[model samples]
Target chain A: MTNELALAALGDPTRRTIFECLSDRPSAVGELAQLLPVSRPAVSQHLKVLKDAGLVVDQKVGNRRIYRLDPNGIGDLRDYLERFWGCALTTFKMKSEQKGQE
Target chain B: MTNELALAALGDPTRRTIFECLSDRPSAVGELAQLLPVSRPAVSQHLKVLKDAGLVVDQKVGNRRIYRLDPNGIGDLRDYLERFWGCALTTFKMKSEQKGQE
Candidate 1:
């Protein structure tokens, strides 16, 4: 479920930029929108997508909501990617074994 | 490029299952289709999606196309997930720094 959400969330280039922007520090939608080419509401929409994807978390800091990366969701993606490597290694070994027979 | 393709390739559950089937060893579309709930043509289509995603490759073996995982594309996914961890740690440190200031 998390993987599905994450893959969908990260499927877009604009959303990826917004998500990556918070990597340095958490920021308000307006602040982030300033750096991005998209409008403020579009950034807000992207934030919602990231939130749904389980890739970001937000908190009310007085009047504005500050967005930050969600470590758990990120961990899930990392684990997903890790499995791909395992698949690769297994495939690699099987090929090597076949080569040995030949 | 590979990340986009890999994400799109893995976005589907049916394709994911078919790709996972080849994790143990390469197999023909018919053999994989037997293990899957989908039809042989469906399996062939899934393999084609995986191939386009750069997630899997195929070779003709005795008139059958044997599909295997592509390691380079997998490495790209692994590297993509690895960046999320970097983002996480950076966000963690920034939060810690803010807490210390407060």
Candidate 2:
């Protein structure tokens, strides 16, 4: 998924809460529901969006599916932000130099 | 602005494009319109959202308003992603240990 999709997925407060819950530990839908104020179905729906955004993944652990944060997704977001940071610093430096010249 | 607001503000493709443009250089609304496919008013609208999200800041440069990326906003996004990365690593280590025990 694109970084935009990931950002959009995490844009929701409920989804961010669900993502934070999974960050602490891998969990099943029922467990996530218990941790969050949302219902089981709501958790499931949020999970679907998170999965589509590549922010989380699921693995079948016996009869239950476990969800956990995807490192790659987080890495993508970091990279995207880092790019902007680098550019911002560069622009800042350029502006500073121009001021110094003035 | 909250990170959620920033994320939601960047969720739109047009806003992201406008953000990318700003990263390259500070520009006025007319300049951004020239650089992007969108109209000056559309760029203005996107800039307002970006400003509200703390992703960008504007300063009056004579008769024009210049827009540029805000380092703090980029830093906030990086910090948010890094948190997920740290938790993911910790969870991975714990899962590995459990597997080893099993």
Q: Each candidate's chain B TM-score?
A: 0.82, 0.83
Residue A33, model 1, lDDT: 95
Winning model by lDDT: 2
What digit string (tens of lDDT, one per residue) describes model 2 on residues B1-102? 467678888778888888888877788989989988878898899899898888899999899999988877777766776774677766667778999999
The lDDT for every candidate, in the order shown, is: 0.80, 0.82
User: In model 1, which runs have C-alpha deviations exceeding 4 angstroms?
Assistant: A34-39, A90-102, B37-42, B90-102
The clash count of every prediction, one per candidate, is: 0, 0
Model 1 lDDT per residue over A46-80, tens place: 99989988889999999999998887778777777
What residue pairs are clashing in model 2?
none
Q: Model 2: residues >4 Å from true position, as ranges?
A: A93-102, B90-102
Q: Which pairs of residues collide in candidate 1?
A: none
TM-score of chain A of 2: 0.84
Model 2 chain A lowest lDDT segment of ten? A76-85
